[model samples]
Target: MTTTGPRVEEGYAPVTGGVRMYWRSVGEGGPPLVVVHGGFGVVEMFGDVLERLAAGRRVVAVELQGHGHTADVDRPFTWEAFADDVAALVGSLGPGPADLLGYSLGGGVVLRTAIRSPEAVRRLVVVSAPCRRDGWFPDVRAGQESVSSAGLEWMRRTPLYEAYAAVAPDVDAFPALMDKTGALISGDYDWTDEVRALTLPVLLAYADADGIPPAHAAEFFALLGGGLRDAGWDGSGRPASRLAVLPGRTHYDVFAAPELAPVVDAFLTAGG
Candidate 1:
């Protein structure tokens, strides 16, 4: 519904984590790509950029618990819980596992999906998301920490709130979503070993000026066995996983950046 070109197809997945997740699709043919949005983000947040990503493929997007058209449930929010719901949705859409993409918080979710339910994922794409809690800049971490303490009136005035109010099942539940997200953000995690153990191909995409530093991005790539080899002239030595740092973008806007779709498409189609 947020896109400009493609005719959107909407539906709801069977109950997961006590919420019947809402999902939508666009485009036709080619491999399916399932996209998950950042925190406080709805399917509509993808806006027109989804049109480009949907080209030559069918793109499926989901609204996590309490976000967008999905009604908030009593359960708490956690990366693993969201991943389970997404994985189930992916399975529901599949004759086989689908390629997965996520932005920021959603990036973390899909990463967990690949790790927890590899059978339901073909390839992975993580945009502006960090695998470890410490990957974020100190200031960014500070901001997440302050979310629970931030006044509701102040948050209600934000664009995030406005967007949520536009499509949320319960408009008054915005504060609850914020509180849950704050708790999710405050969690401490280190997925280095898990990522290192992954057998499926992965793509890590980031903006040049992101909440995570380029050094941390390199560290993440290194975990996937990237950046440690010559990758030879023929590129045979390079790891199938990749790292891309788009110029002229930041974490907040990278999801909609014009350059993102081609990069993701290329990765999804590489060596096919």
Candidate 2:
């Protein structure tokens, strides 16, 4: 990962409907890329990848409600609510749509944002997030079902906890965030039909060993008009969509991989 880059600019965007979303901006020139980090993730979670991407384009990494510097609101933690928060943040940034990239929980949030307010998103990238509840591997699904706020004590030793402690506005609210996230993940959901109708170009990037099954990734690609027919010599039959399975990585490490930035850059710059 490249270590050299411009200084990062950090600030909070007052999102409509009662939330002050925190964001970090880096780099200059090119189109703006709004990054949404996964659950329990802060801007630092993206680390080098965020820095690298910022080298060529502006990278706005946002902290969703209850995550990172953003404090939790009274509203229930639902994907739809988070999506709305992101859309409002993007709008507050400026006019015109911005490219969006999200990982895991953030991935689901970005997808929902695209569906709910397509005009706010110019390009979409979803990394290691499943569109439906059952898309996860059996073990992952089972684990999500059993997770609870009590796990907060067990997670205290983890890097995520440490990171949160360093920057979270109220470290004492960790347990509450965990409970809300647990409820959100454990809930049932399926957005296959909505995804199929998305007109914007989409990229589904994941680790080969992601929590989601490899077959399910292919199923998602098919839903986006990929894997169903040959592209022909001119490649006209292919949809404006892509799938990338990074090697030797898992859901935990895919977003931080050195190879991710370039793939995402190429796809987003490819244009519609």
Candidate 3:
């Protein structure tokens, strides 16, 4: 279902703050698949999986503001702001609707984008996403402290520090974003009963070791079961949002593990 493939370089002139974004493309055909990275992550973390996805479809992975290669925002960070960045980027690059894949923070952003711009998304893949009222939100203060202590430069010197370094400078502004993210997570998108509004095939993937435990992820997905069932199927099938607990894996491993590549590939390509 998935295999490694060559990559193509692509650059875009950002509409917001003129921040230039560096994105990589994989594969040559099928619907475009876009990937959004988690907090402290950029495209490189998922490069291998992107390459594998590219073998059958176009895979575009971009850095969020203040992380990876994207420039820092002049304004504060918020889920709305991040979602706006993703919306703008996708809008600028689009030839048509594209498949969307997001993880952790990126996964939340993808959900926001789907609600904000439902028309632009085709298939949606979310890994370790915190659903409405899920009560799992990363603490901005803790993240800020982590980034501050390590120092971006110090982090960059070591392979593990790369992502932390990317978001380090703006650590002070994290609290507000964390608050906003928390509100979204606890309010169920403020609709509480509009899962059908998204109206798109969604593949919910959870990592056993994620910030939100797999059990919690399953609970949130259960709320959306009605919509999935209306769409006809079970788990990733719809009747129930699908659940996969990557054995001995953490939140990041579900997507980045070398051994799980084949599983991920199969999920993305299934029912295609």
Which predicted model would earn the best lDDT? 2
Task: Quote each prediction's TM-score.
Answer: 0.96, 0.96, 0.74
Name the 10 consecutive residues with the lowest summed lDDT in model 3: 183-192
Q: Sort every candidate by lDDT, greatest first.
A: 2, 1, 3
For candidate 2, write residues 88-159 as lDDT tens digits: 988987888999999999999999999999999999999999889999988998888766678987889999
TM-score of 2: 0.96
lDDT of each: 0.89, 0.91, 0.64
**Residue ranges of candidate 1 with Cα displaced over 4 Å:** 1-5
TM-score, candidate 1, is: 0.96
Instruction: Give one digit per residue, the lDDT tens place, for model 1 in 160-256.
Output: 8888898887898888888999999988999999998999999999999999999999999999889997989998898989999999999889998
| lDDT (tens digit, per residue) of candidate 3 on 55-154 | 7777888777666566565555456676677777777766777778888778877877777777778777777776653435456324433444235445
Clashes of each: 0, 0, 5
User: What is the Cα-based lDDT of residue 26 in candidate 2?
Assistant: 92
lDDT of 3 at 196: 45
